[model samples]
Target: MSELLEQFSAPPLIELESDLEALRKHAQKVLMQHGFPQRKTEAWKYTPIAALERRDWSSDGPDESAARTESIELPFDAHRIPVHNGQIDTSQLNEIDGLHIEPLRAEQIDTSAYVDHDPSDAFAWLNLARLEQGICIRVTHTLERPLALQFSSSDQFKQAAHPRIRIELAEGVEATLFEQHRLHGSGLINLVMDLQLAAGSSLQHLMQRQNDESALIARTEAQLEQAAHYQAYVLDLGGALTRQDLKVHLNESRARTRIHGVAALKDKQLVDYHTAIQHRVGPSHSEEDFRILADNHSMGVFNGRIHMLPGADDSHSDMNTANLLLSEHARINTKPELEIHAEEVTASHGATVGQLEEAARFYLRSRGLNDAEALALLKFGFAAAAFDALESEPLRQWFTDRLKQAL
Candidate 1:
């Protein structure tokens, strides 16, 4: 743990301004005090970081000229922001009306809310301490096209990079955010994202990630105000080591959020997802559905938790997770929890893990489809249902096509 910490605490690749330097120093102090999570940590027990600790960060990374890999081609037109090897290429940023992009301000970052005294939040603190690039995006009106954030790493990339991003939506604004990650090589990318939604605002958030070698760790925190609505859809194919934590806070009455995600894993990949939704006021609502399909020697983990605070009367929430193990060696751990402390509040949670039904597979095989084809169709059908609530037809179709290919 100390070795890894030393590597992460090395001098920043880019010099920091005075305000950012102070924040970084504080974050570094807190991180060093807590260190990293160990095997006994409940939240990290199933996910190991031994591989990350073994990495040698002394090698020179990819050449700066070759760091920018080709941008991913999107099915729909969008205002694109391309980040290559953890560096945003400002030249590629598109100018769109009603949208603004600028460097992240030191005042916008507040790490006091994180549980820094514990190792569970060590990665979040590490991100703040070693952040290389930071950006803030603002949306003030309905967007004609989606805003796409494309992140890719080169094949020779071998250094850890930290990037922070914040998205702010003004009151009564409506927009769509499409985030894609394509990672290669054997480096690490630690990311932190903040989402702020004002009153009467609506945001459609979509995420798609595919990686096989690199390690990816990310945390996303969102706060929604009165009458704000936030919908998130995530599709993660697989990776060598992937861990994501998503938390949403409904701070005012009538605020609502829905999350739907699917993780498809194969080979020796590992993917862990932890999501929490908090109803802090009266009459808020939240719904979540996540599915995982693990094949080969892969392992998958999902933990979904919902909390209704004392003053959150009339709040309602539902959470569910379904998992399938496609091979004898594959493993899955899923847990759904609900904590309610308010009167008249309603909450429900469930989780299930099982293999494919033999009877259904036999029926499909008897109908002329080969064994492999039948299996693919069944898996696709099971995973695709999670995205049924997506509003955009094109985006839904895109997700469907990607899922089919992934299977």
Candidate 2:
């Protein structure tokens, strides 16, 4: 942990923003006090940071050649915000109606909730302490097109980059947020995102990520007001090392959220996802579904937790996770938890880890399909159920196509 602290020191990166100096100092203090998570850290025990500690980040700095100038190609039409090597190209930002984009100010960020002396949150604090690029995106009216955030890294990228972003939707606003990550090289991309949904607002969040040798650690925190709706769809194709923590708080009545995710891992890749949904008020709802397919020597982890607070009466939640181990050496760890404290509330959770059924595979093979095709079909059928509830046909098709390609 101390070695990681030394490697992640801020002095050698970029200078801290003057306006956020105090906050950065506070974050640094918290990290210094607790350091990074160790083997005993429950939340991070399955995901090791030893690979990060061994890297020499002394020569990791911004390089002019790392700038990406090509536009990201997407299957759908949308507004794009491109982040190259963890740096946003401000010059490419264009004006869009009903949307306002600006540099994130210190006032827009509050680290009080995550600045505690808990080593499990050390990465969250480290993001604040070493943040180099920050952006604030606000939606004032319903958007006709999805807002896409494309993040990619150059093959030469070997430096760690921390990027922070805040997204807010005004009352009655309806928008779609598309986040795509395609990273390469052996560096680290530690990202933090904050989301705010006002009353009567709706946000559909979609994410697709595929990486090579880079390591990605991302944390997203969302707060939903009265009658707000938030939905998330994720497709992770694995990487060298990946960890994501998503926490959503239903702060007011009638707030609801649904999360669906799939992690397809192969080779020596590893992916870990930790998601928590908090029903803080009455009449809130949440549903989560996650699937993982690990092949070769890959590993996958999924932890989904639902909490119904004391005053969250009439709230309901259902969480489920299904994982498949495709090889003898492949491993998967899945846990689904439900903690209910309120009366008149219903919550159910289930987790299962198993392999493909030989009967089903044999049946598919008997239907004129080869062994590889039958296996791929079986894997796709098991994993595609997570996205069955998606509302958009195009998005559903896109997800299915990507899943097929990944398989």
Listed per model in order, the count of residue pairs whose N, CA or C atoms clash below 3 Å is 0, 0
What is the C-alpha lDDT profile of model 2 across 106-141, one tens digit per residue?
998967667385798889999988877789989998
**Model 2, position 165: C-alpha lDDT score:** 89
Q: Give the root-mean-square deviation of each candidate in angstroms.
A: 1.3, 1.6
Model 1 quality (TM-score): 0.97
Q: Relative to the true structure, how large is the alpha-carbon lDDT of every model?
A: 0.89, 0.89
In model 2, state the lDDT of residue 215.
89
Compared with the true structure, the alpha-carbon lDDT of candidate 1 equals 0.89
